[model samples]
Target: MARSSTEAEYRGMAHAREIANNPVQHDRTKHVEVDRHVIKEKLDVKLVDIPLVKIQEQLADVLTQAVSASRFQDSLDKLGSGDIYAPT
Candidate 1:
């Protein structure tokens, strides 16, 4: 569902779908969800700051997809940390 679907199809999908959907959807989304749009808006207005994520602390790869043994091990090493990918 996450890897194969087009951005438009994803927006039309359940849960991952946008709440205030338009007739035409964006080809690529700057925000992953409706609530995330707030952060994007804040970023555009310089109201929030973004923090960097260390390579070793990034665990989203596990949920994202299968990877090399080394990378999977890295993910397992830090499964409870905060999400690393910066929004907006």
Candidate 2:
């Protein structure tokens, strides 16, 4: 799950730090298991980057919940889904 809040992101970083510092526990993290280490590994190796996406530009909003018409349209446009329907 992608973190949408700053607090959540901070917690994730803290967890990542713990994983890096503790070799034994890193493999046995309760919340962040071995599978989740791929992301941290990528970050450690600088292979991937986390871009700051604004809430308005979050494409998942369109599928996850109800939103204002304008916000819905914004997400749809950002995700390039506008071609699905003819313009009025």
Candidate 3:
């Protein structure tokens, strides 16, 4: 079975970090293409480390945003405004 997306992301970030540190083309790394766009985008925007937020924290943030948006829409529905709010 293939690795999960989250595992792949973690591996990609680790690979990117290793490539950033070494950067030299070698037999082991020659086949691996680091996503330059991701690195450049991060650097251009001055983002430092890729934050390793806890799963609960991430879930909380996502759920909170989702629920808050849903509540607003529910309120609008109750008020018969027919406004639609998409969950974040």
Candidate 4:
């Protein structure tokens, strides 16, 4: 289910996604404002869908974060995999 988010939250997601997807950065700080509108347009047109995933429930954390043994196993299970390299 898609969760409701505040305008600031949406904009923040849009801004972060823009930065991550694009390699080039503007020299001037003022150009940073345009990133929000560009991403907002993509959302408005259904070009992109940003679903909220809670930090604890994020599957990517298995690889990116220092999760506990149980949490790592949980994430791997969610991805339909076994704890092949789980801490012994």
Which prediction has the highest lDDT against the true structure? Answer: 2
Each model's TM-score?
A: 0.41, 0.48, 0.27, 0.43
lDDT of 3 at 62: 31
After superposing all C-alphas onto the true structure, candidate 3 shows an RMSD in angstroms of 10.9
Q: Each prediction's Cα lDDT score?
A: 0.62, 0.76, 0.57, 0.73
Clashes of each: 0, 0, 0, 0
Per-residue lDDT over 1-88 for candidate 1, one digit per residue giving the tens place of the 0 to 100 score: 4673354356556533553354345434535555588889999999998989874566775666557887786676566444366474
- Candidate 2 Cα RMSD (Å): 7.5
Candidate 3 has an lDDT of: 0.57
Show model 2 residue runs off by greater than 4 Å.
Answer: 1-35, 83-88
Model 2 poorest 10 in a row by lDDT: 1-10
Superposed by TM-score, candidate 4 places the C-alpha of residue 16 at a distance from the truth, in angstroms, of 13
Q: Runs in model 3 with CA error above 4 Å? A: 25-88
Off by over 4 Å in 4: 1-40, 46-48, 83-88
Of 1 and 3, which scores higher on lDDT?
Answer: 1
**Candidate 1 overall lDDT versus native:** 0.62
